[model samples]
Target chain A: GAGVSQSPSNKVTEKGKDVELRCDPISGHTALYWYRQRLGQGLEFLIYFQGNSAPDKSGLPSDRFSAERTGESVSTLTIQRTQQEDSAVYLCASSLVTRDIQYFGAGTRLSVL
Target chain B: AQSVAQPEDQVNVAEGNPLTVKCTYSVSGNPYLFWYVQYPNRGLQFLLKYITGDNLVKGSYGFEAEFNKSQTSFHLKKPSALVSDSALYFCAVRDADSGTYKYIFGTGTRLKVLA
Candidate 1:
């Protein structure tokens, strides 16, 4: 793809429902990252995946938040039993390699009602 | 742990005036700093980065940032502010010594350029 792409630009889900956000990174980018941004707040790192090594999941806020990337292509971030506090913009970014500049997607705005 | 701080929540500047958005960082050893700008309803756009060499690094849209190791700051600057330059700016830092690829971002500062 020409640039990083995210699906379901906006999502409205009821509390306790599960929601999945998808990210299609730029072609050939081996590094993928997920972030969350609440209104009037800075971006919070959620997870990072680099080339098939063990993903750095330290940023995941809670056990209900999980993510997976298959073969450096598409990635999905899933929030189980979403809480109202989980309403925020979920962003995805990709880079050619670690420590390189990252390209970001438009992000999916999730609203837990 | 690496962290970035953007002390100002908002900065208002008149068009054609020089503008600056302050940023400071904390990290072990040297720091890899970055600046990104975000427009309404849009993804973040990379503005610039400082890795090594010169202390001043230039980036897209006539924007530049200076890396000060002693002060632990990477302030973004522009000679002239444009009305279109109004957006949210973010500063980020990564630990150079730890080899950790993750970047810690600062709370964003909103820039408003009045025409």
Candidate 2:
């Protein structure tokens, strides 16, 4: 795709359930980022991947949150034992390189019931 | 640590009038500033960025932002507003010299342009 794409535009799951959100970054983009935007709040950075380097996971809220990306293409964010506080729009973005302008996806809105 | 502050929770402007959304940021070194807009039920759309050279940066949808280093601020602006311009605005910053390559964003400001 020409732009970043995310799957399951909306997702609803019960608390304590596991959910997976997928992202397909712009072709050839080397930097990928994941962010969570809670209702009425700003974006909270979750993770960053720059090519084959070790991902920067400092912003991840908890151990239950994890992400994996394969060869600068598809990435998946997994939330285990989701909590009410975990509800938010999960946004995915990709850039041509680290520190460059980022292009964002439509985002996957997750609702934890 | 880097951070952004959007002073106003909301700003109301009439169509055809000039609009300004305030944003301030704090960073250790030179800052790479950016502005993004979010429409209802949509993700962020990049508007403009201030890296170096020009303090006034132009972006998509006829939007622009001025970076003030002394003030530590990057305020988004538009010459004339439109009803369609109503949306949420966010300001972000990253330390260009920090080497960490992380961007910190503000809480966001909602802009309502009435026709």
TM-score of each: 0.98, 0.96
Error of 1 at A83 (Å): 0.5
TM-score of chain A of each: 0.97, 0.97
In candidate 2, stretches whose alpha carbon ends up further than 4 angstroms from where it belongs are none
For this target, which candidate reaches the highest DockQ against the unseen true structure? Answer: 1
Q: B1-115 in candidate 2: lDDT tens per residue?
A: 9989999999999999999999999888999999999999777888888989999999999999898888998999999999999999999998888876778889999999998
Identify the leading candidate in terms of lDDT. Answer: 1
For candidate 1, lDDT tens digit of each residue in A13-92? Answer: 99999999999999999999999999899999999998889999999999999999999899999999999999999999
How well is each residue in B17-111 modelled by candidate 1, as lDDT tens digits? 99999999999777889999999878998999999999999999999999988899999999999999999999998887876678889999999
Native contacts kept (model 2): 0.81
Candidate 1 docks at the CAPRI level of: high
